[model samples]
Target chain A: MATKLLSRYPWATSPFVIGAPMRVMSGPALAVAVSRAGGLGFIGPGLKTTDTGVDLEEASSLIDKARASSFKTLSSSSLLPVGVGFQLWSDDLSTAMGTIEKYKPCAVWLFAPKEGQKDLDEWSRRIRAVSPETQIWIQIGSLGEAKSILQSSEKPDVVVVQGTESGGHGRMADGMGIMTLFPEVADTLASSHIPLLAAGGIADGRGVAAALCLGASGVVMGTRFLASSEARISRGYQNEVVRASDGATNTTRTLLYNHLRGTYGWPPEYSPRTIINKSFIEHRAGTPFEELKKRHDEAAKSGDSGWGPDGRLATYAGASIGLIHNVSDAERIVRDVRNDASRRIQGLAAA
Target chain B: MATKLLSRYPWATSPFVIGAPMRVMSGPALAVAVSRAGGLGFIGPGLKTTDTGVDLEEASSLIDKARASSFKTLSSSSLLPVGVGFQLWSDDLSTAMGTIEKYKPCAVWLFAPKEGQKDLDEWSRRIRAVSPETQIWIQIGSLGEAKSILQSSEKPDVVVVQGTESGGHGRMADGMGIMTLFPEVADTLASSHIPLLAAGGIADGRGVAAALCLGASGVVMGTRFLASSEARISRGYQNEVVRASDGATNTTRTLLYNHLRGTYGWPPEYSPRTIINKSFIEHRAGTPFEELKKRHDEAAKSGDSGWGPDGRLATYAGASIGLIHNVSDAERIVRDVRNDASRRIQGLAAA
Candidate 1:
């Protein structure tokens, strides 16, 4: 059902490159830019407010503005529809459903549900009832979770296989790499006809090409887009991403950063990957959480500079930070990755 | 220097796929088959005797037997020169050097040295002094190691970047995945002109394609080849490799298996990935080490049947085991992966 819905989009002409719904980083402008570039773009879950709902009024206006911009060269059919992501565990279902109904996004990404597969099933059913055209995409990190989803009645149109290398909230302790996880999930769901999207540590054309080879119909990239111009990121965070050389040493999966930033309420089974900053350093050095939190609050006052080597804030990023060398536009990232993958594939085929 | 040496081989015509020198599984027969199939084959470190040096006489005879077989279709030049691997810390250096000097293999892979970078530098210099034609390939799992190698006066011809997902011995606690690690190492050594080979979780065409996109000149696969007919793996181990589906849950990095199997004295930094059998289950369930060892010995007496779900033994494999559905020939594994990668590349390019 989800695969059938995805076929209606313009991804047939080009490989699907998704601008991942990365918390505060993925915003309306980023989504629109990516969609206009012939790839699916998703507004992150951070946009959904607890009291009101998904800021659909703001999102609708932003989408309109993006459509009205210099993207006139894009065919009406070629203009891919935008997607919105929601954290099922933290979100209010009724509010989220209302927002989806109001905006009618092309797709909805469901992640980190509070009540497991049943919650996801209910969410999928509700979304389908409200907007039958809105494709349901579910993100999973383990084979067990994938199996559960496969058995569930609320089958997703697309399954985003997230590896442990991904940034921001993922399977904490028992996560596998995308290289193995993606193919495993692909093989498990081979008979189900559900398209798979490879996520985690993919930052360039090579990653996109590899994901495709692994049987993913598309790729959902977060860290790569975090360095993009349209992403709602602070300069310090973006610069750190560009300057980071070794993702293995620079990035670590920990909740210490989350605690210092006061962003609690995440489930126990999940942890976010972050560039090791001063706060992380101090925390690892055995500083108390209360002290670190106080220092983090003070550091946050410095605005952009609060996220450098010496700063005390979290620079949430995947190990792929080493692959990113610059902060470019979202369109360029998508186009370059697609073109480079094409060139490589062509070269190999010819060889 | 390594790049120049590799160029002399026939890897340029196709994706450079290598049968990794897995400790016990990679034998002369497997190496010859992979080489005959147009991929570099390596005789693993297991051939190195602690006292007598590498059993070069046996290896030589095996190589001769392989050459005398139906591999006449392979041109002498296309028959990639077989490489020999050594665990520097465990093997007698002088005796191993004698074997390399006599055999003069195409490449020598050095891993787990006692004195770190300086030791590797000395080993490379010695290998070159004896056989200037033989290339030095150093395997590293982290960027720190890569940087150290780059800074060393004695440089290697090829750098094998082994991710945490690889089977056998690899970085234990602090390791990065290949998707991010390979690119970072590539960029760091971009100007050095050293060729990079990606290892770990690379099972098929997509893995090969992805590694190339990430700037790898080739890929060294271990676990995938474990399912190859020519590999010197036991029937039980091979069967487990074929039967395993969820590698993330089925395999783990632990010294318990090594201890039970009585294969100790490994460097503190390295740990092998193994499939969870009865031994692992009992160990994890808080069974005492002595009791588990006693049970493992009893199970080993049963031969092949002692390695299944209820068996008390280690099944060494990578997370990519989910991709292997059969135990075929080494030549087929190499050729199929190359062809598949080519096909996927072509399809993506056309798309």
Candidate 2:
């Protein structure tokens, strides 16, 4: 336990796991950017009904980009190991496995599996059968969820723990929060053979320092990186990120935007945190899920227009929005975090 | 812009600004509890060298039963005019104020003459002279320094603001601080225009919501009351705040802490935001300030003997170390700030 805990995660260079299956947001441009930044990047087949985006064809192109870049970095310096993410709940494994087989990406992240642990075990078996080089990474909400994965027949390379501070889709119970949950899960998994990646609310290098002290080898920052040049979100949405006030970023899990956009099927404990923007204000706020679904259907027909606070566009932001005040290159952020975290660690050790 | 910000600062009733001075931590027993639960309890007189503490023959009572209950919510409540605070930059304000003032305080506060904003032209003048019925509150970062009053030739009914984050010093660059500065001059007033106070890093709600926020209509606090029972700091330090992290605080004008600790103080560029334990390890990583200062002076000590990076025995603690970590009486803190400030204003307003 002590040796593994002290050593670097076996599969990746740093504990900083990049979000996988970033949907429309995780294009090849962003993947290369995040990869160069130190955090691993994953390509996703966007199933979001928001804007017309990435499918398997797009995924193939993104994989090609990642594979090309992987060789560049893999030879240049120690790489954080780039990967591809898939929403197992909505995706067909064969299609995802096909991508995995071709690229043999460093990792394959699976989320929201249909049969839960059974799905993870089956996918792990299937992926291993096809591509021996590709490692498996699983994202889970609760300690119980993590336990189930660890208890599975085929162990995963890493467990990405998503606390409530996650910006996109995640567990939304008031009882679940980054402050308490991260430590608890980290402690519980301390005895397990698997390494853990703490996700949510980690913005700066300092946050990385704190999380490392809490037992996580590294962290996966989502909203912090959303405003970077690499992400696929619009300039208007990205600017909203740069201009956001701390008071304006309070969040809660509501089916408001999803229902209004006709994108259903986010499992119950999972809700996204976002700012009160044009689309949400006009269409969702007080409307019921059923009513929202109707509005979503209607908007889908009209080629979605505008981004007012009342407009129906989704601003998938998180609690860490307060810290992201600029649009920067992802590599700069990555370099800064690595150096800062290293400095802080040396400081702690010396003290 | 000055008037607008100034106007918003005074949400108090009448002309009075109470002081919610506290000791150790701003537990309910010391300042906040007193202000919220009693009549205005002038928060503190941080920095041991201040003379206000020596001559005060007023009611002196000690309250320390309800430890560990202080928090920030005490400020937002629209309860009695409450206060808590310090002598601008005092090393002993906590203990001294905790002894004399116990109960509802009105205002507790402090403001130093920052590098860029040198003049005390707008907000300070307005807060001190709010109609004839308001309490004139003033906090001096140094005993030899009352730049606002000296500049405007206008005195607050109560002048506070004391030593830097020290156990016994003022914020002035030299040997001056709120301690040696506040009392020496509080007694030198020609017209009872304002009562002098001390402050800097007070750590309790009693010191915060009580003594400073509500005292004098306002009292000053920097370190006290901020570490109340409900407020969160690292556990290793919180457990030691009262009995351990108290007594030997010190302050200096340098970017030492932030640079060593890992927080960027930019855009709102100002002094170091000193958290007691954040820089322990970093302090050891660099050239020893102690050794450097030794060459600068035989012994002008920011890091003399016991004050290392890890176990910083001397925190940026005010004189109010005894009253921290308890949910002190907020009513008392409120009453004190309200009553004291009101008394000054009431007398003048009526005349």
Number of the top lDDT candidate: 1
Each model's DockQ? 0.66, 0.02
Q: What tens digits encode model 2's per-residue C-alpha lDDT throughout B1-351?
A: 112212323333322223334333333233434333432444444334243343232212232222224433334432223333433322343453442243323343434333322333333344333332333344454323443365455544455554333332233232222212223343344245444433443333222221221112234443433344422233344444444322222223345543433334322323432334423333546758664334323322333333333444324444344334443334443444345433432322232
How well does candidate 1 score on lDDT at residue B174? 60
Cα error of candidate 1 at position A17, Å: 1.2
Regions of candidate 1 where Cα sits further than 4 Å from its true position: A1-6, A11-13, A47-55, A69-80, B1-6, B10-13, B47-55, B65-70, B73-80
State the lDDT of candidate 1 residue by residue for B120-156, as single tens digits. 9989999898888888999999888888987999999
Worst 10 residues of 2 chain B by lDDT: B206-215
Candidate 1 docks with a DockQ of 0.66
Looking at model 2 chain A, which ten-residue stretch has the lowest summed lDDT? A48-57
Q: After superposition, how far is residue A270 of candidate 2 from its true place, in Å?
A: 1.2
List model 1 lDDT by residue over A1-351, tens digit each: 324534666442366889888776788778877877878888888744442234345556665676587654333542236788888777788988888887787789999987779989999999999989888999999898888987998899888999988988899766888878888888888888888889998988888877877778888899999889999888988888888768777888999887776678887878999899888888889998889988899999989889878887889999898889898999899999988877766766665
TM-score of model 1 (CA atoms): 0.93
